[model samples]
Target: MTADLGARRASICPEPPFNALFNIRMPFIYPTSQLSLERKTPVVSTANVGQLAVDLIIASLSLQRVAILESGYCVPVVGAREDGQKGITTALELYGHPGVDFVVIQQRSPVLKVGAYSLVCLDARSALRLQSRKEEFIKALLNFIKDSKFGAVLFLSGVDLSNRTDSQMTTPTYQIRPENSPTLAGTALQRLSSLPIPKYTSPVSQEAQPAESSSSTPFIPGGGITRRILSSLPSEWSVPTASILQFVLEGDNRADAGLLASVVVKILGKEVPQWRQPGSWRDGLFGTPHDQTLFG
Candidate 1:
């Protein structure tokens, strides 16, 4: 399953989203009625074809087009919602670093009040099902990417990957880290703190940092191989929660998975310790912790 280490993704490289100096509009998302609410729900509705919903998810990945992240990165989060705001925040904090170029989009105010950039709002799930236009879905997605300035995108959501047909465009794992190169693997490990990791815990994944650190999770190295994780625990740690993140695909066991989240939440980092398999994680440094929440 592993390939090489020297490969580079023209999409995600050492540069930021707006690499060029000037106020160049990297891309644009054409609005569509298809993005609006359906006819079925007229009376008790405050949503659409998941328009703002999708936008919020996209923003969560892009950093609102600033220095923390690039413009092209994206992800779908069927699991995300105004309630999942903290997790979304954790993901953004985890991924974006002075080192990371990813962003986090969250609905800060009520729909009737404050507004946010790089983000769109939508109604709840039931109202949303009224419009499942896959074509419109992929079109808006494609158009958004073509118009944006960034290179790659990660379309996420609770949506199933195997069931969908047109959602073919995406960044492959090999791009994150060439399947073969140990050195490159080493670099990614160090840069892990660069992206968002979401704060909630699991028996398995997502980035883990303390509840406070989740406010701005950063990827870092150290920790250890899946089997050796117990050895890497900070000497004075009072709390620890283990989980398996959805994005990590090396098919790692709970050990690596746990540490991965610990890093996102606790800022625990070091070299990419040995792992049960490749793609488990990339390595980097564990920076200081930030203020955040704690969950059981």
Candidate 2:
């Protein structure tokens, strides 16, 4: 069935756009003299051809990242605690059905949708492993850009605390953005800046004081593919926007992921009840630290 489908698609697919997009080259090989001469036509793999078509179809959808959450803590080899993934799951659960679905580019990555917004959870282990043969990955992403629409992409990941400078004080959340960005990207930055930090309220009195925030655009070391993918996407689509939140890698990364999700929710102008409180789970399997201190 797959072979038949491939053949039917081959008969109808146009050559120009696909050739240019996938960098497909056509070269025929020929052998020796008249008696021994053998002619061979260039062969294109059916799987590759099918994948391109699939990318085109999927990318054509109008999808936006009203809110996006990306995490790399739960990789295959690490088998370490998946703090980031768990955090995202918990946040989505708080908001009822988050449109749970999977869009398999290379591996079956999950996509959570809330109204017009989307939250994409990516695992860097498989993505980096597949980078060596990036034909499908790149083609799928490019097609997604060409077909769909994205308001802005928010990259969320944990960073190594040791990389912090003296000026920084504990688990600082840094925003990394390009010098010039698309409208959506710029909007993301604007919204984030405008969002009022959670304020402390006195029980007796009704006074509220805003929370403190730090500013820095430090390079995200050990960020895997999350940073690279978002940063390079704008160059491809022209109108796309992207931003990154590299939280300190120490302690409970699950809480870190939730913290990342909360920021996204706030920027979208949504209300989060008890947003500052740390997420608690009874498993105690990952051994995540209980400190949940978001600010210094």
Q: Please, what is the TM-score per model?
A: 0.21, 0.41
- Report the lDDT tens digits of candidate 1 across residue range 1-296: 12222232322233322423232443323221122211111000011211222232233323122211111223322233232333222111112223333222222121211111121122211111122222222333334333343222222111122322233224111112211112312221333335454332122222453422332222212111111121222344222212222223222233433333233322223222332321112221123454466432
212 in model 2: Cα distance from truth in Å?
Answer: 34
**Candidate 2: worst-modelled 10 consecutive residues by lDDT:** 36-45
The lDDT leader among the candidates is: 2
Q: What is the lDDT for 33 in model 2?
A: 17
Off by over 4 Å in 2: 1-139, 185-189, 195-218, 234-236, 274-281, 284-296
The lDDT for every candidate, in the order shown, is: 0.25, 0.33
**Candidate maximizing TM-score:** 2
Candidate 2: residue pairs that collide: 83-254
